[model samples]
Target: METKTKKTLLPVQGKILWDVIILSILSVLCFLLPFAHYTYHRVQWTVSGLQFITGTSVQDGEVVIASQWLLIAFIAAAVLSIVFALVFPKIKKIRLAGFLIILGGILELLFSVLFTMQVQYIMADARNAGTSYAAWLLALIAVITIARGFHILYKNKVLSPLDFMIMPGCIYFLINNYFPLVGIFIAFKRVDYSVGIMNSEWVGFSNFTYLFSSSDAWVMTRNTILYNVAFIILGNLLGIIVGIFLSEVFSKKLQKLYQTTILLPQLISIIIVAYIVFAFLSNEAGLINKGILGEGNEINFYNTKIYWPFILTFVNLWKGLGYNSIIYLSAIVSIDKSLYEAAYVDGANRWQQITRITVPLLKPSIITLVTMSIGRIFYSDFGLFYQVPMDSGALYSVTQTIDTYVYRSLLQLNNIAMASAASAYQSVVGFVVVLVANGIVRKIDNENAMF
Candidate 1:
């Protein structure tokens, strides 16, 4: 029985060993394949990975040296992977072998990305210099090697079933959330499509100066921050009121109907909502203009700037109220009914019970939502500011926010670097605001603060 078990295990171990050796060899071979394709002064050419490592001269007399450190690191990782695979199993360090393989795969993958970026930077002036399929194939092999390493770890009991279950989500989060963070570098670059984004010249704070130097900066900043402030205060206040009202309703059917009716607007597309606002506020053939004010007495709501602040505030509140109320209502439902009953027995009226019992207990939820809102105070609802106003130039004074300004700049100038700078500014400021707000909350009530 022991001999049969040993024989069966030998094939499995041999298969894993062979897989690592083959992948390491293939990674080394990939360096001999075409790594980049380029066109210089209307002449096309391809450069192999080995040429990139050894350094090459382009048509324009530019000496292109893709990072020597990265090339050396990649070669070292591949060589070490083969050596470890052979030696570790002999020493019975199988788990250490798996870790080394994982490290090697990560180094190869990092080398692929960094090397391509470096190549693009060096060949920036080329008409269309780009990474070839060999680089991507190397990256794919690196990914496979990583998966195999993880499998070995699992077999050795280094990883749990739950780790495998969460692996997909972790990978998705890295690709979707963390990977795009690299674009933050664009804010500091003067982007040139011919040279690609990574190769663009650095301009320090020049991109940011476009926002601060302009007179419109203060107006847009005011509009964005004030509107968000109103939205946070009034949205939460009304949501709590409606949530409490809904909780008190005796009829379940009527409550559901009310809930559905209110949430309908939240579900409506922003474009449709904009049109709905236009239908009511339009100067010609509008419900308000024709039915109430008459034809000649029409108020040019879109052209007039004074009414917009209130109009926008109302529209935003109306549209978002249902969704906000549902959140508070869910929190309200989870409250102990015994508290409200006890308050009633203590001779507290309905209003007093709400103020003394319901609202106080809802503190944690309110604090959480408010902290989250503060984190986005620098951002604005672009549609609410732009589309609802019908893009009337007359209302630019009141309607302009950071988002709309960046959008208009993008449309008119097509300055992606400037747009990226504006976004980075908002993100950084919003992050600071959230930290400040949470710190204040923590000072006031440590338990309720969102850490």
Candidate 2:
């Protein structure tokens, strides 16, 4: 007997919403249509023959670069958005359209700046390239409308709603985090505030040379990486142990008390913690010297460099242990009880159950936490290294970190450009390190990887 085969049908994909279509059409129109024209206005005479959209103008009978690149960027972005809307129509594709539109807006801004800067050069026979307020308005509208369309897709459930909630935060980061990237220009320039930021002389990497040429480079770099490595390894190990122990406690009241006691340190301000450390380690009035070691045998703990590595490590673990363990404890609590019951049925002891089942189950969490920690391996806790050690010059060998070094240099030199250069270096290295770490995690176990 021949059996008839059943044909399986895939779920139909949702169509791109009307809002996205309307905004995309508008964006394309803004790019293609004659939205604005460049003109020259000096004193009383006026010249208005430059067309921005077509990138053409008869200025002083000579062909000039009339914002051609800016127009190309806008047209390219608009074409890309239309292609995505029609061909793919996925939420991710719509989001990409929004990103392209933002880029186009940025290009419009650059065009205005460049044209303003070249207004004098374009002056031949009293004709100069001038910016049009309409171009800026059209670019602004395109960006806002595209972003609104992306939001509408999320609201209609064509995209995840969670993304819509974080839109405000994304905007904040774009403004705060990414907008500061313009300062990188200051890093490369010999910033003379006397002649505004844009008019500053370009020095071409001279600012960065001082950082490498510094005598304390190796010491600071070594201390930062080594201390962070120790913290990451020890922090994860102790956090896991404490978390497991906390989870195993039978009384809920006792668990709460233990959790509260450990967590209190995390809430305390670092400055207060610094003072508290000072109170304990002060030579004349220290609790350690007068109360424990006796007044005659007092040690100037602030000036002592040798003991700070161990001291800082201990303090870091103590302050952060409770907070870090809470994450592990949450994962532990969510685990299935039946597995433990089955382990008990097989006559497995508590230690055996932990070793065999609990630890194995916690692997993903541990891996995830460890991967994140490694990303910050190039960074050091500034307060722990600086304030906790009292920033004593004697302790520089042991306590100096990238942040502290930058802070110290900034204070002593008061050179904004140099400080900016250091910051740019740190940001670049940190970014590369994070990417490398995430890549490594993805290679090992794709399931537990952050990306």
Candidate 3:
């Protein structure tokens, strides 16, 4: 029976093997076709993928070097696919061949886009120049090859329909989230726009000096960590209180109304919040000045350093409370009601039932949120710190967290490397803080800790 099954599979495998081999060869041959066209000061130049990969010379003795690594990768993928098709010629090998084809196609597409962008950047003054027809044809061929590869894998049961369903989200994250992580290199490099990012000169830790060597370093660091500490403590405490209150409310309509009312501040734009704050605190026309304090007692709230810490803390909590409460409420809702019922039967008052049952059960949710918050302790709300303070130089001593400081530095110095370094530093510190916090939690309660 096994022999008969193998005999019957041979014809199907043979057909797929030929198809893979043919597509692989065609993808390689695409390199010989015209890849891009450029016109520099009335001179027309058309270069093939082979020429681009080898480096092409244009007007003014300028050499446009397309990334050779991409060419090498494409060739490698094509070679591996063809070898697999011819040598193994089994269902598993055929599926592997298909994956290789898809990979080669993606590489080819990236190469085409990057090559075109490089040429355009180099010859900025060039007119009537862009990717040639062959380039588009190469992309089209790549798409078809990728589709054929997926078809083979699916037909062979190597990939299920569920895999296809999740494929889009996987691709989205690969492109948007994971791919940009490569930009971390920008923190270490002296970026030159004339040459692309990969070709930039290395500066080591010099970019990092902007963050630590400055006089404001202590001020920003202190403000960032302290503000985050307050936010985590106050936000979680109030959120649990609000969540518990909402959970206990018997009227469904009243619960929803209160939920929406509390949630409205979270939905309001920070910019609008700033202006609303301005309306109350404005030195000249503010309601406090015009209505309560009268003209003679008018105070400059934006420039006053003392008022901002409380103002910012209040604003942050107001905006975050509803969202935070909703999260805790979900966990509260999921708790077994029988525990609370048993506590009440044992002569426990409402407050005792809450303390003994509700809050204890909420320990896991609180720990999870607190652990996550610790990871971002080195960061702050940019709009809340910057905009609410109205960019007051007087308030810098009180309000300059790491994020606002980075934004101000970028604006004043126009230094991309320095900005990247600041970001990288915050990320590293936050990551460490999270690990330490989680370790402490894990030591205390192994089950509640988030790994």
Candidate 4:
């Protein structure tokens, strides 16, 4: 049989009508469900739909999904659920059909269930007690009605409710995240607590001068930037190599074991990870001293500045490689096996298949990882440098990055100004690096540039 050509789905305005309806229902359900819904005698998932939506037991906060929550997740689910309903009817539970449709319907229902669960999770996010469900619902309804009113007045469907996705996201990002970025200039200000934020006098590069004036500035900054560069390079390379090797391995069980093993460090917490590292490197009680070498002498890891760069890079990779590999693995899996068959027909060996087919296809993911990484090169992993070293001054030469330096200062001086200034410095450096890197990527491969 000939290969099936795929058709791409395009977004349309009319597609969002279903979303409006579903969202309206979700909003109303959220508003009334808690009062109408019930829970088991003991707190459990068997609670009423409203309870599932409102249940509080800090997912991020004692936060009920809706109970004491005030129903923010309910409104969110209602709104987004409507959008999914309108645009992707094929995936909608009420509209599913066909032989594979049974599985598809189960998956869609699972998706919806999981999606609502996630809304509850985000509502409990460390961000707040929960967002205001009433305010959000009112805003959503107002926005939808206004859009429809505008559509009727213009007598042209120039857009639809789905338009809010891109528009609202852009606007909120600009207002909340990007707008605050302008404060980077404050890094150069002589910010005194008494002077207030904006009232603080502008020092015009004085803050930067003060930073550079420190003797440890160059060393710390250099170490931070260099370590990040090394992480971005080595982390992605190792991740891709491991991902590709796993993809090529014949035994599915072994591949899964390796994947899980590489991924474990990423899943574990940094604090726990520091303790784990200490178990091996501790001077007296460490495995290296007692178990491995059969010696009881302490290694005095605190003073070992020379070993830290390598140690930091290794830890960074160990923590990140599995997570990053998923991207490469996805790219590899997406490649048409026909390409591999063609390579094999040309007498290409397994090595040749990888070099010729796998690496080339994975370039997009690699570039993306590198570019995103370059954007954060000035920022160091706070956990790795600070907690891992136990904050020993002896290792400061290698471990004291801009982040840890700022933290150390924060603790010693209680100086928020300096901390903000250091953060601003990292942002400026990181932003400039991202812009330059994007420009270079654009020159080399226009499609890959983030812009």
Estimate every model's Cα lDDT from 0 to 1. 0.86, 0.70, 0.81, 0.65
On lDDT, the stronger of 2 and 3 is 3
Per-candidate TM equals 0.79, 0.72, 0.84, 0.62
Write the candidate numbers in order of decreasing lDDT: 1, 3, 2, 4
Q: Write the per-residue lDDT of candidate 2 for residues 198-265, one digit (tens) a residue.
A: 66888888988977788667787788889989998999999899999999999999999999998999
Q: Best by lDDT, which number?
A: 1
Q: What's the TM for model 2?
A: 0.72
Reference-based TM-score, model 4: 0.62
lDDT of 4 by residue, 1-451 (tens): 1232112222322334443464356446544422221123443222233444545543323434322333444355455545554545454222221212222222333333433443444443343333334434444454453444344323334445675457678668756886566456566666666635555777787766777898767987898988988888888888888888778878889888888888888999999989998998887788887887676555666677777788778888889989988778878989999999988899999998998788888888889888998888898889999998888878888888999978876788776567767777777778899999999999999998889
Estimate the overall C-alpha local distance difference test score of candidate 2: 0.70
Which of the predicted structures, 1 or 2, would earn the higher lDDT when compared with the native? 1
RMSD of each candidate? Answer: 5.5, 7.6, 3.8, 14.2
Better of 2 and 4 by lDDT: 2
Measured by TM-score, the strongest candidate is 3
Q: What is the lDDT of residue 342 in candidate 4?
A: 89
